[model samples]
Target: MKWPILQAFPSFSPRYLRPFLRLCAQQSALIIGKKLHALILTTGLSATQTSFLLNTLLHFYASCGDILSAQKLFVEIPHSCKDIADWTALMSSFSRQNRPHDALRLFAQMLENSIQIDDVPMVCLFSVCAWLRDVGVGSQGHGCVVKMGFEGKVKVSNAMMDMYGKCGMVREMRRVFDEMKEKNVVSWTVVLDGVLKWEGVRSGRLLFDEMPERNEVAWTIMVVGCVGSGFSKDGFLLLSEMVFHWGFKLNHITLCSLLSACAQSGDVVMGRWVHVYGLKLMGTEMDIMVGTATLDMYAKCGRVDTAVKVFECMPRRNVVSWNAMLSGLAMHGRGRVALDMFPRMIEEVKPDDLTFIAVLSACSHSGLIDQGSYYFDNLESLYGITPKIDHYACMVDLLGRAGRLEDAQTLINQMPIPPNEVVLGSLLGSCNSHGKLQLAERVLQKLTEMNPLNTEYHILLSNMYALAGKRQKANSLRKVLTTKGIRKVPGMSSIHVDGHVHQFSAGDKSHPRTQEIYLMLDDMVRRLRSAGYIPNPASQVFSGSDGIEDDAMDLEEKEQALFSHSEKLAVCFGLLSTKPGTPLYIFKNLRICQDCHAALKIVSKIYYREIVVRDRNRFHCFKQGSCSCCDFW
Candidate 1:
């Protein structure tokens, strides 16, 4: 196959070298690339071959993420003689460097020079548009694809679908996907991710169920969606089915998502198993993402020591690693330790906005008002990160908890953006705690005006009126709510026993064990009373009544009504079903009513056991006649 010319010179001409170098660059072979460069220099073809060889080198460097070298070589290529591939290569390099704006500028320059658009440039532009969420620019690129008769190309169409999805145009993404003559796994994964990120887990699950063929990516996407959307149980359930029933091999991605689900659900036992399996499967060379997920899992599962061990064992640490450890410490009420890690984080990884948010959250939970305030105020100055709405909300919570209601209000008013429902809700709760009736009323009024359909604000206002001894006002509010068909939300509680969840609502007698629960509650009350516990009648004034009735029958009815709150029944059920010295864990869907809180304190002392109850807003660990919330929540 040897040619006569190659036999004569024993080598190809520099003119022939161009195509060879271009091919080597396209294939991304460093060995062939260096050999080509040396051959050009040995032939004394520097002046003649510099431009083409440099362009080839630039392409190789850009593809390998050596952007500095690529940029230096690109600067040597004269703009007047640059080809389409050179322009495309530079745009792609900038895009990979996270400089989308620079890529767009280069695209504009290429267009001005009348360079014909190709699939590579179109994909690069679409990628930039996706990153910037610039739908208009993306549509313009689509038009170019159509005009160039490249609309039938699968790769180009996939890029378009990805652009629409990342820009949150789910309907458009589906339209493009539906129009495709054939669909691949990538097409399905991208659209599914869009649905999960924008619509929710239910939508993603629906799409997944309808999919004819499933791959590992499809399973991972669904699992991640479930965990992210607060349906961690569903995620774990799916993971179990995939492994045992579907016979899918678990990979790093699968294990990572499952670990996140366990962390979020606070399933420490399952998390430990996942950790063991991950070590056996991945062989301890865990990526940063998997390490972070495991650390977060341990922290949320109330095992800060385990989280610390994972963090220490990680081969490399990033900002997310530090944030995970700090967040775990904060969740476990080890705020001092979380704060102590801040300096180390800055020294190691240079904390970012999310890092600050985690640290600030720890401070807020620990009631370190001054520390939280300091970090919040200096976020922009110290880290060049502006405080977002969540940060402001945490600040409001911190100030509100410290009983500095006026200061919190002032801060809310001074915020660059208007306060959202969370900020207002935090303020209202603080007012209720401090008995600041007037301020509570004002905040409620504003909240109702902003969101008239919100039932929670109406309930809060009604309770505020009752606490202020304004029965007429409370009654009027209740009447309005009744007319609007807005009944108060029923209080419900659940306790896990023998791996099954048992739920109860206020005044509920539907459980099969109802009679036994009632009997147990009665006996517990007697034991608590004998231990010098007195009923806190102050919480019985639902209608602002003194609860001391003129008639004995009316007093008896009031006492009966107070005993039927859902938390009380759940506590009773826990006492009867669980053994002695076992800590009872109850989850309530609302704030623990004042009566329930006092009763539980007495129950804890009388039974000589600790009861941990997590309510809507805070945790109440009642032991020895005291609560961790200090009777404040």
Candidate 2:
């Protein structure tokens, strides 16, 4: 690839200088390009071959990210000598720098100056419009393309399809695709993405099958789209097809997307399988992205210990990797371990805003008040990171959890920024836990002012009232919410069995194995009662008519209601479906109630099986009548 030396060739020949300039641009060798430019000018080649060299110079400056230099060179070119390629180079430089507005402005200037438009510049302009998601500008570009008779060109037509698709004009995008006399993989892929975004996974899958040929990108898009649409199982099937049927090597992106799907669906079994398959594909050469995704997947699936192993196995770690690991630890209630990792992390890479969030949350969850306070105090001075709202919320949570209600309130009042609902909600949660009825009322008032329609705050306050034996007040709150038609989110629990996720709600009988599940539930209840298990009546949030306390219901009936809880049903179904020694992994949409949490500990010991429940707050690993949280959560 070596070029002839300057003295070794005819300096006046554009042929020799053109290739040399191209080489410099490709290598991003600014000094070499400038020297070559000087050689061209000194030899008076610029006077005769000005137009040819100017376009190359513009491209060189554009490639090197010197947009200013390129602009200057572009402006100095004589108006008659200026061509569409020069404009494209300048427009493309701005586009590459994410300056779509500037690129559009150049296009407007080209129109005003009466410059003849060509397909190349038109394609660049359409791409700029797509990046901006500006449907108005894209439509105008489309008209110009048609006027210039460039719509017949395949690349220009593909750009048009991409522009309309990105702008959310799906019908227009499809029309362009349908009318195209020629179509390539890019054409099919662009329209497929639009269908996935505007339509759902089913329609996207339909169009995907219609494609004459598929590439890695198309497969990856379907996988990611399926994951986002809550069809992770289908995404896995697509991956299997791509691998087993097509024999395509799984790229890092596809692997990461599959891992993300597993995490979202809480499918740890499939996550482990994907991890092993990724190892086979990449072997020991797995990059930071895939490794980080694996760590996050294990962490999110309630396997923090295995996530730690993945983190340790990574050949290289970045700030993102550290943050993912720390968040996982924080999420699983391993605050002490997360804190220990922070010092080591800072020695290699500086902590960012997200890092502090993870560290502070770890302290809050672990009730390390002293450590949390020290970190909060030194956030600005030592770490040069200011305490954001999330940090304030965590500090408030830590203080409240430690029974410092007055101090938590004082800190909230002293916050430089107004406290958000999350901060107020944390304080309210702690208040409920500590039975600070008066403080909880004040926090609830502020929360109501922030978001009146938020039924969660109301429910928390009502539950607090019920726990305090203020049955009348609790009923009143429930009646008001019912009148307004503001119902709280229903509790849901899901368990992944045999690669399919089964979800259950309170009193749900939608599953095909309902009869078997109920029989197992009956057996579990009899065993539990014999083991001296008594339902905590105070945790019965939905036991009565319209969520009112069922004062007339006897103890046995209340116990029946408790057993019908979503988590209980999921647990019973797991017990019936899984092997005796198998561990049950249950994911819940809300916090585990006091009754369920207590009952699960006994169930773990009596059944002689480990049960890992990932509730809204944290992981609860119940084993032998003990929970990993030590009953703190």
Candidate 3:
């Protein structure tokens, strides 16, 4: 293994040194590998005519992550010494680095040259295609593999499944899997993961049950599918089955999946339960990933203080861990806390795109205009995190929410890329909030062109017209919606109690306890009215604004509209079911309306309950007539 000994055998042929270089390539130590490379070069043991030594050298560098050196040698390789494996090695390096564009281009070059490619390179290409989620290239690769008869190969077939699966093409991936004559655990797992992505967890569970033999990965996929598909309770059930019944060791992946489900559903009880399980599984030695997930779940479930404790106590912190805390704070509207964590995070780990996005979102949700401006302005220069559409969207939302309508529009105009629907929608929402009819109309026109079928813009514009007292325009808009058969998707709110989630839409009365829920609602409204609370009429105007004639409604009708909103129904149900002083957590599909927020504040005081509402934008913790976000949202 010593390079000094390689020179002692000065008469050794390149063939004799090939195995050692191959061994070096497999082991992958930069310093140890560089030593071997120096030995080959110094001894002139690497022949210019023979490609075996060059291929091994290239593989050594590429696999060792010295990709630049591999690329240099790859480009300079003599025509006679070049081989398909050489290109594949480079492609794999790029693929591992998530640089699929470079890998795909190199693969195209191989096809153009008509090089004699086999399954190894084809498999690598498909793997990159899967990561890139490029359906076109994946189809081409699939065809090529079939023509070359590599489709029969398990590795190649599995790669196709993975590529299609990640692309959300569940049927294609399943087809590839079903046709494969020989299958491995990875083959089943890849297809199952793909199904989970496109299909729901129920579908993924069916697949999991159908598997002839389930491995750890199969179990992990089902757990992930359940949590990712909004069935956190199901995910926990799967995790328990995997560990207790199947005798599979509880791992970080399983724990993380459960935590993710708890975060998504805002089930603090389940989140804490998962936290306890993670501690039991890992003991005092907590992994960074599991710790991060636990912290994220607590923060998202309205326990920011607990998340902070976890962040401080984590044995090791990474970019991902820091991003989780920052994003969680952003979700809870703790923008100042998130910003304060940034400098400390900088000293520990370099911020990436996700980091900046979290920071920008925190600023946007918390009205940190100056802080948001600094981060959005200097993100690229300071952190080298290039701003994508989401980043730009956050910046626009920040500016728009701050009443800088013209500045938000200017930022949209100045975007290096065209503004997406989210950016345009943010500007439009600002217009709706500030009653800027002219800007709202301009933004609406662009939005309608971008997504002609979506009725949200139409509804928003109709609201704008009604708010501006343009009754004729509002009526014309409603007529257009009726003519086009466009109906707005109704907003919904959900609350989890004991293990089941109860969901309600606007004016909902479908719950089995609907009678009792409304009765409780009457009591709550009476109590709130007695406490000097009044139903906001503005809340009435937007209540049935989807083509409804709000101008025709009387004051009493408006009050009924406020009382019938989905969140109000869910809260009333909570009051009916839960104990006094118990916190009520409600999650809304859309932004919590000003009226609902105002009502919840008084309800919190009247009921002597802490009410937590997580809407589309951020968390609002209502306690004793005040909110955590302070009405900023």
Candidate 4:
């Protein structure tokens, strides 16, 4: 009664083998894959089975990035036998490999082959169209989906939304979203994120508010939207509301968004709090994104040491992590360290434009002119990255800072694209620094012609004229400004005192503590005089009539005006209010005036205190009768 040998052979189903082979492919278990292939052949099912088994095998190979194997297996399948799943899988594989053109070609071939299009193919095609920004291809995919009656499929609808959004066609995305009768959390997220990415944060917030149901993704999208639109404070506010008010748990994405917000806002305290809480929630196994955001937060908040610590502790580091550390070093004036990290980054993870920019900026800050030039040249020679306007501007700044004005101008002249305001402005700034009046005049002419509305260019040009004793030209420029009703931007200073920011401007006496501030300033001046500080009468501009006598009077009036300059008054206020040893930190809207600079050096030595002033250009750390800039700025 024993069964025949043919009957004893176990009847196998491809479905049971399909998932197993997929797992093997995903894990890159080549040995296992060969073993399974051999098993399929020995089982005598390879030839007898439908194309389903062969297509599954082909998909497995494609998913594993074995494109050659996939192509060979695809060839083995009869041309007339290609199905929708086979075509979709191959196209998706190509898309994943960043061969979008190949993917599109395959899609076109599938359509020509008259394969029955399905939801999967529609999603894949839509994604390819989006990546290529082919509005026409996207429309064709949409038409196919409509013909197939798959418009309601969530996956297909989401792909269409993404396509429209990326093409800057928010209206089309909205139409697709409106037609979807049943939207899951992912559906809403897709539409909301698309709107946010395309239209901006305000529109994203509007969509967020309109949503009836909210999820972690919804909140995260809104937080990112705010961050993208430069509303970091608003993003942080939204994050706080989500956690404390809404009782939502924070995820890695949420932490990244919140940390990014803190970085942009320079809110160190809030950033630290978020970092601590994130660690408590996610533990020490932080993802690269969260860790990078944390590093960026510390760096931007003037805690570069903290940023370095976070970076060093990261279990895994990507290009962004390296860039963050490099930027932190640059920001802290540790340009050598930044430069040191550059080669290491190149060896490890190839430098990008941003990385080079960071390195160039560090070189500019630390005056590493040779290294800066080498990197600048190498950006094109080695990396094949033609310098953009920003790169050129950085180089101009580097050479200009090093007193290579003519070389800087030559670089500008050689720029492939016409120099924009930033490039020319940088050159003009260098000219002003080096007292190259003629060169500055030429640069200013080009700048004013291109940017008539730019007030800073006019101010700088006038200052240059005044510095060179071109009194009539300066006077004429002033008259022009007056006629145009364009007032000089008032100099403003901010001092952090008693956990609040106190703002002051030139001739500002509106503060409630104005009388106390002035009295303190007067006393400080006496002390400064006793410490051998002498007033410089030449640090002023004449603003009266055209005659020599009136000009002399105007010069005297200008010197008196310097005494009331915002930075001087802010420093005096700090001296009066703060403890004698505490370092004073002041932020200024403009470069520190010459008189204020001289006065701060005397004030620092007289009071035996350190003063750190951040002006429009760079940090000036004054201590012991000298500034960090060495009076070069």
TM-scores of all predicted structures:
0.67, 0.77, 0.88, 0.63
- Candidate 4 lDDT over 1-633, as tens digits, reads 332432423555676777778888789776667666666767667564746678878878888877777878888888766677778878898988889999889888887877777799788888888888888889888888888899879999998988888787888888999999988777778888888887888878887888888998789888767755546567768878988999999878778877886665445545787899877876778888999999998876556678989988888888888988886676556788888777777777877788877888888878889999998998888998878888999899899988999899889889999999988998888887788888888888898899777667766767668768887887687667668886666778877565345778876799889998888777876787787766654454421111111244555465556666788788888988898898787767677777678889888887888887766665677888887666654
Best by TM-score: 3
Expressed as tens digits, the lDDT of each residue in 420-506 for candidate 3 is 899999888888877889988888889989998888778777867866778689779877877998777777888877666788886
In model 2, where do residues sit more than 4 Å from their true spots? 1-200, 225-234, 448-453, 469-487, 542-558
Candidate 2, run of 10 with poorest lDDT: 542-551
Say which prediction, candidate 2 or candidate 3, comes out ahead on TM-score.
Answer: 3
Cα RMSD to the true fold for all candidates: 8.2, 5.7, 3.5, 8.5
Question: Better model by lDDT, 1 or 2?
Answer: 2
lDDT of 1 by residue, 391-499 (tens): 8888888899779999999999999999998889888878877778889889998888888887676666666776677867876886787799865566777775654
Residue-level lDDT for 582 in candidate 3: 94
Best by lDDT: 2
lDDT tens digits, residue span 1-633, model 2: 244556657555877777878888899998888877777677566476866687788889888878988998998888877888788889988998999999999989988988888898888988998999998989998999888898889999989999998899999999999999989999999999899989988999999999999999899888777765657578778778888999988778878877887787687766787899988877887789999999999998988899999999888899999999998998877899999999999998888989988888888777778998999999999999988898898889889888899999999999999999999999988888788998888889999999989888888888788778897898788777889988778888888777677888888899999999999988888898899898776677632211334556777666667788899899999998999989999988888877888899999999998999998888888999888877675
Q: Answer with 2 or 4, whichever has the higher lDDT.
A: 2
Note the Cα lDDT for every prediction shown: 0.77, 0.85, 0.83, 0.77
**TM-score quality measure for candidate 2:** 0.77
Clashing pairs in 4: none
